[model samples]
Target chain A: MDMRVRLTLAYDGTGYNGWQIQKDGLTIQGELEKALSRICSASIRVHGSGRTDAGVHALGQVAHFDPPPKFLNVPWNRALNAVLPPGIRVLDFARTDRKFHARFSARAKQYSYTLWTQGAFFYPQRRNFVWNTGPLDLEAMQEATTCLTGSHDFNCFMNKGTEITDTIRTVRNILLAPGFTPQETVVWIQADGFLKQMARNIVSALVQVGRKKLSQAELKSIIQGRDRALAPATAPARGLCLEHVTY
Target chain B: MDMRVRLTLAYDGTGYNGWQIQKDGLTIQGELEKALSRICSASIRVHGSGRTDAGVHALGQVAHFDPPPKFLNVPWNRALNAVLPPGIRVLDFARTDRKFHARFSARAKQYSYTLWTQGAFFYPQRRNFVWNTGPLDLEAMQEATTCLTGSHDFNCFMNKGTEITDTIRTVRNILLAPGFTPQETVVWIQADGFLKQMARNIVSALVQVGRKKLSQAELKSIIQGRDRALAPATAPARGLCLEHVTY
Candidate 1:
């Protein structure tokens, strides 16, 4: 019997090259496989709920793997974290039925983009975690997020090389929290799923509107136009974090 | 005529050993001296409010130096930050009175330590910051702080190598904020002066009492006893931040 293990993981993406296997560099998936293999004493394959680009963080990323027979006594949560690096931590673990899959079963994903406006540089210690946009207009950005909320063809908000046949994505919720703090603005978006660079692209457009480079009507037109060329540049991946996953 | 130069600095404290100028590897003072030497075309000495041991951090550390002829109009703040490596930043610049001294003339200082009990090894980025101590009694810790206020002999809290002429310091305040949403605790301390590892050591002792290791009577005895052996070990330096300074 194939035993499916579901793991909720959080990681500082600054050190790894995202949540996928890469032949050339360090990656979250690579590190997990390495730890799982050592603990179970057999080859293992781990799958993630979604792919986060390089420098993007994750607070509640979900993954599942089939445990090898030799490692029957290995506790999925404790054993894995003990061997993993400092930036990666396992929050919770569960034994799942064979029908469950992390990537396939995730019904919705939530991501948050932090914008620190007061200062261009971050707290030296937290510099790697937040995006420093340097004092943006909250009302303008909030108004723009409303236009980005409903279902739409998100081709305009995706990276150019994305290979998905359909670039359509339904943004289930986009709660633009304005003036939450004196020094920071935050945008939280939850969607059925996100295309490559979708959240970042949306953020860039919001930033533009906040800076007065674009109008709300113009932003709505960009979404309606459904042209990749219509959106602003992709915001840096460092600012985005996968906040949670809903099954 | 003597000129006063105010410096707003940032340092990683990971390399070159602490903030003071030592014969060892690299010190923040040594780096600033080098930058000043190049900019001023003459050697200049820098004085910090206080010395931070190796592996400490500062967001708004205040320092003062006398300007040499060549450094004039060099845009010292921007130039120095650009020249400094990724770990240090010079955020602001000011020219002050000739009587100013960073160490002796300083009136007060504020420090904060952050602890999170989440037990997740995966810190979002910049995990090097905020020491992670699993769940502890913050209310107990806050209560313990009241025992430490006012003028007291802090010799018990000083580290082994400290060489201060006096052991008595006035603690203006010690604020204990209960854990925030992420199960994090922040300890903020303000004082007229501090001994070596004083804040860290005080935090250590308080934490022990907070976790039920020592009683409040024991805490009073340790302070009155003025013996270094009576207190808990110094807390990790990584979690402590020199938050503010007053001249």
Candidate 2:
């Protein structure tokens, strides 16, 4: 009988090229594969809940793997964490029915893009994890996000080179939290799925709207237009995080 | 006429040893000295409000520099920030009275220590900044902070190697914020001054107190004892931040 394992992980994406396997450089998947390979005594390919862009971090990223026959008794959760690098950690692991897939069976995903409105040097500590955007109008950004709620064709917010067949998705929630000091503004979005540069693009547009360069109607029109050229540029990937994945 | 320049700086302590000018290795002061030497056309020394340990960071670190007559008209802030490396940035500059000293004139210093209690590998994104532990009880920790209040002999919390005649200091506040997701905790402390490793030592003691290993009376005894052997070990330096200094 085949065994499937579900593992929830958290990683700092600064050192890796995101969650997938890459031919040229380091990746979260590459590291996990190496660790799993050592534990299972054979090669293992792990499927992630989604593809996170380079520099995008994760707090609750889910992945699954089918253990080879020889590795039946390994206590995977503890074993993998022991050999993994200090930047990536496995939070939880459990043996699941063979049918469970980290990628295909996911129902909805949540992401958060963090921006700091004050402090010049981008926090010397948190520089890689948050986008530093001097000071922004939070009320304006909150009003602007209302336009992005519900299902819509988000082609305008997709990355230029994305190879996806569909850009339609439903956004379940859009939460805006503006900080009082250290000056921060956070946008949390939950959806069934996201397009290639969807979060970044949405952030870009929302940022412009926050700056009062674009109005809420302008955002609605950009999505209605379904043209990638109509949206603002993608926000930097460093500030975005894959918050959670539900399967 | 003597000129005292007030400077607000931000630095990544990972590469440099700390803020002070030391013979050991790269330091934030050494970097600023070199930058100022180039911009002012003469060598200068910068004095910081406090000395942060190696691998520590700062957001609102204040420093002062007194330059010779020749560079009086130079646009120091903008020119210096332009030449400084990516990791260090100068936020602003102002000319202070000749008697203003960065260290002696500081009225109070606030420090924030970030604790991630989720055993997850700190994301490379935040690796240099936060201290990761796993699942801590915040209310218990807060309840224990009461022991650290008022003026006490802090020799127990001071590092063993530091030689200081006076161990009495006043802790104005010890604020505990519960973790964001049951896996994070933040402790912010404000004091007139801190001895070497004082903040880390308090955290170490508090962690034990949080875990119910030590009673509040024991904590009081540790402070009242004035013996370094009575306190818990020092927490790691990475989790502590030199938040602000009141002049």
Candidate 3:
């Protein structure tokens, strides 16, 4: 019996190269594939819902794979995790049909970036997780988000490397709220899909707007300009996390 | 002219061999002194409030040092942090009187330990910060605290090998509260002073009582027994943190 299995994973990406296998360094995909192949005694390709950049964490990244015959009755969540490193965890596992794909079946994706804005000093506790941007103007940032929501051509907010022909994306929602503490600001955005570095660049543009460097009019123009150079530099990957994948 | 300086520090202790400097391994104290020495161009000795074992973290580990002449006018906090590794940070600095001591002048200390007790999967984000002791009985743990609080001889909870013979200490406060998430149990404890590994052992005993391995009466007997061997093993040091030191 060839059963397709889906695994919801959460990883601390601070130490890994990225979600893909690379020749130069360790990666989340490399680690996952290594454990999967070893456990089932067969080659495996772990297909993630989407690739996350280096230092970008994930709370609910979805992936699907077909295991070898030996793994038909195995307790996958426990067996796979037993061989994985402490930085990655298999949070959930279940059988799925071959027609269901981790990437194609996903309806939406939610990403969050944390900014530590109140203190002058960046505490070591949040070093690899949050961006230390002192005193961002939240009210201004919120107002600028109004120009960002809904359907728009997002070429301005994407990295130029990938050949993404269709640059438009529907940004369904965006919210800036007080994080776990008053000192932190959590920027949350949901979209049908994200372009390469799209979330980071959008966040960077908003941060510039919060700093009053880019006015609301300038932000609108940047979106309409359709130029990546017109937007602020993309934010650091350490601050970005894929929070959910809705089906 | 020599100036006495006091510093408040925060560190992620996941990688080092504890707070005190050792002959073989990297430690928080070793990193701090190295940065201090390089910045001031002198061999500086930093005296901390106490020594924390390997894998133990600290949010407000207090220390004081007498700087050489070249460091008299240096902005100690920013200067020391510039050269320190990302794991350690100097949160604050102030000039103190010659009589003020980091260890002897401290009146109280507080420590907090986090335990993950709800889910079968231990999430990677909190791997080094919380103990994964799934599904502890909080009500029973609450009932067990009564026998453990207040002034008592804590020899059973203290790890042997340290020369200090006086095992009596006052546990002024201990509270079990809902953590950031419903799955977590934050154990907050304060004491006038602590014996070596006293906090870790006390928490271990409470956890044992919660699991029904030790009854409340058994916990009381264990403390009264004055035998380190009678108590449960000291909890892992990674979950324990020096939260505050009051002077």
Candidate 4:
């Protein structure tokens, strides 16, 4: 008998190419499948809640897979963790109904972007995890985020190469809050779904506003324009993290 | 004219061999010297407060050097940080009198060791900076520390191969405290100076007491014995950090 297992995972994305399987580079999915296949002595595939780009970390990413009955006796969470590298961890595991699908059953997601506004230097430990942008006008950035909240056609905020027909996304909230230090700022966004590069693109536009390069009214016009060329470049992948996926 | 300068630095030890220059691989000293040489347009050498072993990090490791007077016009903290790799940073810099020496003038030093008691998994971000020891008896470890504090000959804890004639050192305090997370514990030790591997070796013995392999009485006996064979093995270098140096 085959049983469905749901796994909640966390990872530092410094070493992996991305969440998807790629022929030329290492990926989170590829390493996971390899470990599962070795444990069960059969080919295994895992479906992730969504794909995260290279260098994008995750605090709570959901995935699911079917395992043979023979492997059911093993403590999967511990066994899988023992085999996985230190950069990735299986935070929790449980048996689930066959109807559960990681990608299809997800209803919403939350992402957070960290910006280090400290001038000159950054802590060595966090150099790879946060965007070091010297300094920013937080008040201007916060005001600009208000223009991005609620339902809108996010075509201008997505990667132009994506072939998806639907560009509409419902942004539940956009929050800009102070982090642990005076120079640190965290931007958290919750949404029903995100198109390719949507979150990063939005962050880029807000950063422009913080730098006083674009006004809040111009931000609204950029969204209304519905043109990807009108928006600023996407923010670096290191600052963005998939914080949670709601089922 | 040569003017002595003091530098307060921080670095993640994941990439370098250690604080000292090494023939086989990259070291923190080598990188810092290279950057200084480039800025001064001449060969440069730096004297650190002490040499940390391989894979040991630093939060406020101090150093000093005299640069050519012409080079003093450049902003060192900003100039060196711009040229150095992301893993190392010059946190502070200032011109000091000729009598100021990073090593000889230091009055005390503080070292911290982090142990993660979380079962089954380690956070990816801290995987290299902490010891994932699962669980430890805090009370036993605290009791064991009392025996190791105060002025004493730490021959049993120092690395056996070192040729330093005097093993006498004064330990001002040893603190066992909770870390940021419930499952994490931190051990902070302050002393006039440390012998090679002394901090790690003491931590190893305390861990042995936490596991009930040694009693507080035996730990005291180990110090009295003044024999390296009487102590437990040294802890891994990853968990140790040179936190600060006072001058």
Candidate 5:
């Protein structure tokens, strides 16, 4: 009998096209499948919990796969890493029940966005990991998050091209706190599910509030209006990371 | 009258060849000179405090150049960043007297090396910034540093190809401490002058001591041996960073 195995993946998405297997480009899934197949000596498929856009990193993205029974007892953590590239790794692996699906069994996901809010030029070591935004009004950004928390019809935050009609998502909170440096701020958002570009779009609105270009009251009205046209542009992809996914 | 201008640089050396200008490679100095020459409408020469090997990063590497009188008032902090690639950044700048040389007038320098000493894989985001060594004896590594502190004849620690006969220099200390994660250790080494691959050579020996292959007393013997062949191989350059330079 074969058992389902789950793997927690961490990757610097800057080098890949995205998380999905695409015909024309390199991706996190494609790399995983290639490495796994080589180790198993057979065809292998990988199912990620979800897709991350290009340049979006992941600290703990989950995936599940059914491996050949002969390979079940392999020391996966070290075995996978030995064959994988430097930009990707298997952080942890464990046996799971057949009912456990990488996507449908997920309960919530959390993402963190980094903003270098102090100066025109931040440290070069973190250039790929942050959005440089000079200086921002921290208080206004915090106030904007309060309104975005909890369950809401976030149609306004979804990308205009996305076809999802039911756009409600239960955003637990948007925690804004200082990062490694005082001038840097990391915004963490936890939600049951995110619509296409929903988290980035929400962050765009909060940054607008921080800039004083949009008021907190205006943000509330935009959600009630449910018009994507009224929302600000989607934030850049490099600043975002899939921090964790809870089942 | 033309005055000397000092510039503090920060760069992710993963992309550039090194700190010096070379005819065959894309180097950090070559890029800086190109950008400055374009801005000044004349060829500009930059003098770094020292050269860093390929793949070594810098948080506060210092450099100096004499600017034309007409361009003296240029807001160099923002101007340099506007033209340089994302990998290189000018953190600070100021006008200085000709007596303050970026190379000759330096007092001391600090470098840091990161090691992920827990598992086969570390966070992919930090893959380029750390040396992944599966579990090391922390106490042994700390003990080895005791014999290496202060001014001494470090001929054994210098690289073989280096021709410097006077190898005596004051090594302030090498501090090994816990990093962001419990399993990660960061080593900070401060010195008045670093010989070619001296910092890396010291770390290689320390790591060997941590593994129990080289005891603390054996390290002392190696120093006494004063033979470059007796020293361990130099550590990888990616894990090293020129943290600071004080004048």
Candidate 6:
């Protein structure tokens, strides 16, 4: 009666060290494993779809784990949520076949970055959830995203020191939309895969273009050059969120 | 020359004691005074419309202070916001007549209390801003509000140990509406003035009616009884917010 369970998680990453298990800091993976182990009364391992940097939130981060038959009768989602801290929640859970894998079964992912354009004051409630950058040229940023669509070698947007040799990523779309507030904007990017710091770096480059510090043609050149140093510095991790994953 | 300035303030009260200045704990008033004093190079005292309880938020809390003429050249709102912590913000500021008083000139005030009915989990970002109660009978609550409207002595709903003797107050309206989330509900109450904890106690009584623990006629009797001991416990301060103050 052993079953593999797939769980969709949502978490506020303000206090987490990221999705991976680290020895010195708190992490999403560490908390999930501990909660699952406590609930099942046995050691449990969870495999996440991917690693998110420190301070990056997630609304639909998927994971998978195997549970013994005795625990299967319990309402797993509610049981897990009761033990988890308020910052992390299990949004959905279901039994899956043994062949299903959280990381390998995912086909695409989407990330959204929020920017507060108002300079007069910062919203206290959203202090840890958004990037407060005073005013940007919206038209310029929108035009810059046009060039970012489609498949490209995103090595320039990737963080240095990463071991992945394949720098290519297929960007399905790049969208800029109004956020919940009038002074906020959301940048949503969908891609087959992302390199380390790729989403944040891409946002930084778009911001530079909006600020008129880098021309559209220069952005194109930077991507073509495939040099990380040539692009603008990576945007802060707080503004980035893993919004969805398409399987 | 001294110029009286009116400031509309907003703050997330998660980290502070309350709006009043307290010796042993951090408070919104203390922080505002410190920021204003630093900006003006002198000790500045601010007069708030009223004091909000510990953990109560505000969207349009009004205050006033006199500033030296030299400081008028500075953008007061922007300057104060720069120095204030992220939890507090100055939403608006303007020079007012010497006769205008933040506390005395206010005609009425509006307060809103948010109740999160979703029992599945708590929202981390809103942990300090909402009351997490499971589902309630919205229609029953609405019916119960009918007994709470109009001018009356709200002694039964008032928190004990207050020095104010007169408890008669005019309630302009009591509104119950759906909150931003489908699982949440908002209670908006407007009045000439509210005694300490009156709004919260009222809501608590209404919730009792919603749960069928109390009847509408019994709620009317509680108001007529005018005895604080006869009423239900006051609702948590985290759910209450000073939404607006009318001049």
lDDT string for model 2 (B98-155, tens) is 8999989999998888787665444444566667766666677898898897898888
How do the residues B90-131 of candidate 3 rate in per-residue lDDT, one tens digit apiece? Answer: 989998777889999999999988888876666687788889
Q: What is residue B28's positional error in candidate 3, in angstroms?
A: 0.7
Docking class of 1: acceptable
Residue pairs with colliding backbones in model 1 are A87-B122, A117-A135, B16-B26
TM values, all candidates: 0.94, 0.90, 0.97, 0.90, 0.94, 0.88
- What tens-digit string does per-residue lDDT give for candidate 5 at B123-162? 8888777788778888999888988988889999888666
**Candidate 3 runs further than 4 Å off:** none
lDDT of each residue in A137-242, candidate 1, tens digit only: 7787887778888788887887777579787788988776642234667679899999988999888899898888999999999988988887888888877889
- Candidate 1 chain A TM-score vs. reference chain A: 0.94
State candidate 6's TM-score.
Answer: 0.88
- What fraction of the native interface does candidate 4 get right in terms of contacts? 0.67
**A50, model 2: CA deviation in Å?**
2.0
Candidate 2 vs candidate 5: the TM-score winner is 5
CA lDDT scores, all candidates in order: 0.81, 0.82, 0.88, 0.88, 0.88, 0.88
Give every candidate's TM-score on chain A: 0.94, 0.95, 0.97, 0.96, 0.97, 0.97
Instruction: Give per-residue CA lDDT, model 1, range B97-179, as digits (tens).
Output: 87878888899889877776565443534355566777677777888888899999888888777557689899999998643
Q: Show model 4 residue runs off by greater than 4 Å.
A: A137-144, A176-183, A209-215, B137-145, B177-183, B208-218
lDDT of 1 at A95: 86
Highest-scoring model, TM-score: 3
Q: Which ten residues in a row have the lowest lDDT in candidate 5 chain A?
A: A119-128
Q: In DockQ, how does model 3 score against the reference complex? A: 0.64
For candidate 6, write residues A1-247 as lDDT tens digits.
Answer: 6589999888889889999999889999999999988888788899999999999999888999988777766777888888998888888888888888999999999999999988775667677778988899988999999879899999899887679999899999988998746778999999999999999999999999888999999999999999988999999999999988888
lDDT of 2 by residue, A104-189 (tens): 99999999998877744455555676778777777888887778989998888877666788779998888887532345677898
Task: Report the CA-based lDDT of candidate 5 relative to the real structure.
Answer: 0.88
